[model samples]
Structures are given as structure tokens and as C-alpha cells.
Target: MLLPLLVALLPLSAHAAERQVVLIAHPQVTNAALTRDTTRAIFAMRQRSWPDGQAVRVFVLPNNHPVHARFAKERLTVYPHQLQLAWDRMVFSGTGQAPSQVGSQIEMLERVATTPGALGYLEREYLDDRVQVITME
Candidate 1:
């Protein structure tokens, strides 16, 4: 029984180890780092500026995207469904605007890399020179 259980869990562990999500921003963004709480607020669409006070332009992949789901849960400690609900509530209630949505991670990377003060996240494998990684404190 123990051997069978170990075998069953091996693939799950391997898959988990294969993914690494990271916060990224336009190269021009002035803030060097952010605390986890600030990152959560920014991605949650609650905060509107960097610590330096530059306007924050947030981009996001479609809610159903795998990378989006992982980034929300792992980096922001929020569920994708919960994020959708929050965004919906904000939009419908006139409290806030939804983050600009991209159809794919490639597009998200492009948008953030080119847009001033932009912010978003991507899996490690998709990263390139166009954007800078925002280290979480």
C-alpha cells in the first residue's frame, strides 16, 4: 500500500516542481521591489500606484489560463474564482475597473514589457529581456 501511494504521488510532485511563477514589470518601472501584501493589493486592483507614486498599469491573462491560476493562488494567495468574483463585483458596483486582460501569457509579457509602469506575472520559462522581474520582499 505504501509503495502504491508513493508511486501515485510521484507525478503530482514532479508537475508541481516544473512550474515557477514570478512577478514582472516594464523595464521602465521605478520601484525595485514590493512586499507580498503590496503585490497582492496591486494585482487585486486595490492599489493604483507604485511606492514611488507612478501610475500602475496592470495586465492579466484570461482567468481560465493555467499560468494565471497558479500566479493568483501561489503569488497572491487568492483563488482564481475569488479573483473573478472580486473583479466582477468591482466592475458591476462601479468601485473599480478590471485589469486589462490578455489572451495569452505571450501577449501579457509583451504588453507589460512595452507599457510604461506596467505589471504582471509569468512562468519562468516564458521570461525574456523585455521585462524586469519584481522581487517580492
Candidate 2:
């Protein structure tokens, strides 16, 4: 009975582990905030600069990463597979460049914190002093 109960609760525990994602930018990025559409554009590699005209550098985790999937769906309103295909098309067609890919959340946070004009998403717990949280408007 105990084993059966535990199995039933597994999905709940996994869901509980998921946290809201925050759009974090390097301290040097001039923009203080971004709209949902603009944020989507930035992640989609469609927008290359901050609203203030400063160059925007983007970072992302691997397509299969949980945080990447959540952010792609919840915040960007796009699926991870779609984003991957879009990126591949852009790279292949010479229309755009892909966002820099990091191996893990820790690496993502570290790169975004140190690189100027950088932007990436992180679960709330991964946030730190080195990066600024860009509020979604």
C-alpha cells in the first residue's frame, strides 16, 4: 500500500519541483524589462538588440533540458521542438545566428552573469546577484 501511494504521488512531486522561470540578463544589458512578444522574439533569435539599441546576446540550455522545455512553453508560448527547428532553419538559411548553448543551469547562470548583453531564463532558485531580472511586461 505504501509503495502504491508513493507511486501515485510521483507526478505531484515532480510538478512541485518545477518553478516559475525568470528572464535574467547580464548587469550590463541596458534594458530593464521586456514585453512577452519581445522576449519571445529575443529567444527566437529574431530580435538582436535591446530596445535601447544595445546588442543582445542570448544563452540557452540544450533542447531536452527541463528548464528549457518549460521556458519555451510557459514563457515563450512555443514548443521546444518548434524553437529548435526554427533555429536550425535560420542557421541553415543564413538568416540568423543561434543562441549560445550552455550545458547546465549553473553554466547558463554563470555565462549570463559574466557576459555583457546576455539574456537567458532560469528557475527562481538559480537567480543571483550578478544578473538582473528583467520583468516581463
Q: In each prediction, how many residue pairs overlap at the backbone (N, C-alpha, C within less than 3 A)?
A: 0, 0
TM-score of each: 0.85, 0.85
Residues 51-118, candidate 1, lDDT per residue (tens digit)?
Answer: 88899999999888999999998888889988888889899999998899999889989999999999
lDDT of 2: 0.90
**True-structure lDDT of candidate 1:** 0.89
| lDDT (C-alpha) at residue 29 in model 2 | 85
**Per-residue lDDT of 32-92 in model 2, one digit per residue for the tens?**
8899999989988999999888889999999999999999998889999988888899999
Instruction: Please list the C-alpha lDDT of all candidates, in the order they appear.
Output: 0.89, 0.90
lDDT, candidate 1, residue 19? 64
lDDT of 1 at 134: 94
What candidate 2 gets wrong by more than 4 Å, as runs, is 1-18
